[model samples]
Target: MLRLSAQHLHELAQYAGDHGVRVVTENWFALLDRPAEVLHLLEALDGEVGLLLDFGNWTGERKYADLAQIARLAESTHAKANYDADGNLQTADYAHCLKICADAGFQGPHSLIFDSAGDEWTEIAKLRDFVLAAL
Candidate 1:
């Protein structure tokens, strides 16, 4: 994520019109909670610096913060992950997260995450297919 912030993000936004990666995903809670600060940084960005709402990475306090601020910047998103003891997805209201994005006017081929451990690609792909199928 740091490689993205210091280099890719600003550059991608700057060169958005030229790249197919016109949108980006970022850790939601990592950005400032104050609306002004968030808006200021985002406004400084090129069109490419969109939101990628991660369900699993927020502070417990911020977890319940209303979606208004983050939702404003979303174009695409990620559901991250919430798995059980068996590595199956936890029974959380994932649909509510999707609703938040939808209400914010994002139309996403949103990602669903699995293990962020080793060889995450195969698991991510599998989860992605599953989430797609479920949706």
Candidate 2:
């Protein structure tokens, strides 16, 4: 199963490239949740695919360092933000997180992923504006 999965990813990357579509994998799954494994896969793919870095996907110890390492290879980003009912971030620091991304040289377009107890579009717009300012 593991081998098949890797093969499938390679095949998908090849197919996407043949069609002029870029294939990017996210670090959401166990197989890709670590920096070493993610780097291994990226090396194996040899630019056949890119990485989509997600700010909120990794948690626990070393998340910041792991994110910093992954951010260096990011072709795209999911700049997710979590907020309280009052519209303030619960605990995550958007500025610090974005600074890590910037320091790692990630200047790609961002996908504002907002999780809030408010209107979705409104929250998206708000987060988008914030991310725009930060970037």
Candidate 3:
């Protein structure tokens, strides 16, 4: 149960603002796994926070729907991908994921996040290119 209190988040947001940086969070924690929780936090912070939507991060039922609900608030994206034995993306639908972000008007940076064997850079490059082209 990864958690960050609203007060702590507000303090961090203020600190980041003072330093000329924006604070963002990812849905990589149980506390942030739900759309309502994320929205509530953003509202509590007066929308001073940014969200980093991660593809293929949230699993279980209605994954895409949940993602879309959060994507609308996305300031950035973690374009994570899964590759097959032949080094091809197989786990998730990149186009579907990208489309959701696009529909939500997310035009920020797409950071590649893929953990696999073989050439890391090569896999990253492949995902990067795919995301870029998709965007």
Error of 3 at 133 (Å): 2.4
Model 3, residue 62: C-alpha shift (Å): 1.5
Superior candidate under lDDT, 1 versus 3: 3
lDDT tens digits, residue span 80-117, model 2: 88666678864456776788889988879888887667
Clashing residue pairs for model 3 = none
Order the candidates by lDDT, highest first: 3, 2, 1
* Candidate 1 residue lDDT tens string, 1-135: 344453656876667757655656565455544444455556666454766666665544545354556776766566766666666655454555655666677666676666545467777776676566545
Model 1 local distance difference test score: 0.60
- Assess candidate 1 and give its TM-score to the true structure: 0.61
Q: Candidate 1, after superposition: displacement of residue 63 in Å? A: 1.3
Query: What RMSD value applies to candidate 3?
Result: 2.2
RMSD of 2: 2.0
Q: lDDT for every model? A: 0.60, 0.80, 0.81
Predict model 3's lDDT versus the native: 0.81
